[model samples]
Target: MRVSFLLFAGLLLAAVVSGCGGGSAASSEAASSGNTASGFTSSAAIAVTDPVTVGTLKGMSDALVVGDHIVVRSRSDAFVTLNGQPVYPGTRLSVLDKQGKLVSTTDYGFTLAAGYTGDWVMMLSPDGFIMVQSTSGTRLQHFDAQARLVGGVTDLYPTVAATSTTEYAAAENGGAVDGNGFWLATTFSLLPVTDKTQYVLKLCKFDFSGRQLTPPFMISTSALHPRVAAAGGAVLAGWLEGGGGMLAMWSKGAGAPTIRSINTGGSQPYPLVLTTDGKMGVLWNGKATMTSTGGVMGVMIDNYGTPLLATGRTDLTQETLSAHWDGNVRATVIDAHAYKGGIAIAGSAVGALKAGEPITDVLVLADYTLGTDPLSSSAQTILRFTLPGRAALGPTPVLRQMLFDDHAVLLIGDDNRLQAVYTTRNR
Candidate 1:
């Protein structure tokens, strides 16, 4: 059975703030105003809108907020015969306007049969082009802003090793190449080092049309999960290896990446993000120790790869913030994005009442400024949404965290419908 439709829903909450800086008076005032219907308050200058429906889907999917559109890739559970073949579920691309209204939908002409699993990465170029690269036979697929599958590139690399890990991609200007200013920082595992124990990690550049603009630059033979980001013409990638975080800065015409390794400790680094001020920010989970609480920790570096914080890294989760939770909490960094002169993070926090008690989880939103003293401002829980408990027998719903139009939005899917809550900086 084939099902396609668009629907609208009511707004649950709308809280507006008036200033910047975490744990500031502005945040306190907004929280005290009791302007929320969902029990979530604003910490920074942000305004949250009502929930809207994007589309319906069954199985796995992905969603991203592009300039003025929300691009979604959805697949169903039912099968349909196409060209004398039963396709379990081919991937479909859907585009929705800012108002959560469906704009367009198209099939990628690619499908993954049952029990097939591989890594997939979707990136939006600065020029509104959508690029989806996967190790699941879909090497690289490109789509225009209207959600049309234009073209794709042939697979040139070997299959990823089963034991090797992968990471997200970042896109930036190509610096006057082929009338396509967009390029992506991507990684590939050419061969296994020791029978799937490790792999030779190589970073390369690919234009929007899937053209390999530069040769694959080898980074490490043991690095896993390369996270890439670009801003102000600076391309950066990082991964985990040697019990530390490996960071590298690459130029469009450089021989190799100018690399550096930082002590990420027990926590793994999240995806690399491009700050609004043309700098790169790396956020990671703070490993819980006997001396400190486990929360979110981050570092910001300039284009030259210099740490802007005096401590090299700052722990954003603490009790001093105006919008803070009680007791020690373990944070799961679900998503992070650069928006409105800073970076916003959305995730879940699991906290217990005491050392030996039950734990509850709450949706967390944190906001930080991209200023000279970025670390001086703490990461307060700007907004808190309660995550509804789920039943035991069912697939986990898809949760997407997005930062667009000065708002932080979260999309949750269940029972074939996708509902979204949009939050933005009102000022």
Candidate 2:
């Protein structure tokens, strides 16, 4: 995916103090009047509508939450227009949530320059300065968010990475050539906080009060691109290892990271998810054995990098592999039967005990609880969807992405269209 860079400049203004800040009458009056002179408004919503189907095909590049709104970007050369005006192509489309309706839309016109997995959208402008058009792509601002304008935009590198709920890491280059003919690597500027240079990676934590909790924590890697995932007060930082197309994971307070020892052997491993509950899962292509004879296998790892499961048959020709992980830490693997080519093999945390359960099947949602073994929990299937006509399952066949939100499962099928299946069981 191509990440675009656009200069965001508007005005300078202080953040509006909310009633929650203190019991001052000024703050109370501001709250009573509902005057959001600051770009950041207390109440505003966003949403998507009549999304353009690019080339008759739908593609979801990336998405993130800005306040109460959900912003989504498409990888295809597609632009979403509200009313009829075309939103800026490559710029992220905002979806605001208001009461029960989508209140407004805003286009920041900034292009993401890196992969979307670790990157997200952030609201840089204050509520009033950030004017959003209904569907006309018009620019308006009720308030501004940028208070201090650093050096001319040219000298400022607007690279940003989210570090926590209210904190972000931003860096800039001084535009000076170093001995290596590269731009003089200037110290990363910890924005919205202290101006002191204490660390190289420019690790700094800032709360909504604009206070810096800690000095920047330096890293050995000069080009360390820290990817932060915050959950339950734990922060996991993931970054790409130099030259080795592998990922390195480290926790903020959990000391050094335990690198993955297993070699991709050549295939690239994709980091599918890092759940808020601290469960990390990765998917990669490999060989596995199906019978006692011998064969290849598909590889999967747990949060601790433990190889808990593998799939594949001895015959080099049989390409059978599929896997899915539910909340209970149970993984379901579907593979082709080695001897019986027509018979599909289905294996789950519980199916492993059933010996030879049916193969060639679909997922069935059932209530499940964590078992002692973690990987072998039982789940009752409340519903199932069958897929017609079966072929030799490949390692990536059933490895489609599935996201669970609000008791609803959103599956991105091979066709790329999102199918949201919700569970209606009464609690």
lDDT of 1 by residue, 1-427 (tens): 0011121112234343222112211111122123332222233344444445565543436677777768776664445676897554436677776645567776544342233334346677655555444443325555566767665454434444455446322211111112333333344443333345553455566676556766867667666555667655556777777667777775445556678775676455553544532467667666443234455666666655555554443423331221233224343434667666666665544443223434554444556555555432433325544333311112345566665565555665544566665555543
Tens-place lDDT per residue, model 2, 54-133, is: 22222333333334433333333434566796433433343422111223333333422222222222223332112122
* Global lDDT of each candidate: 0.50, 0.27
RMSD of each: 10.5, 20.9
Q: Against the hidden reference, what TM-scores do the models get?
A: 0.68, 0.37
| Candidate 1 global CA lDDT score | 0.50
Which residue pairs in candidate 1 collide?
11-50, 46-425, 47-424, 407-423, 407-424
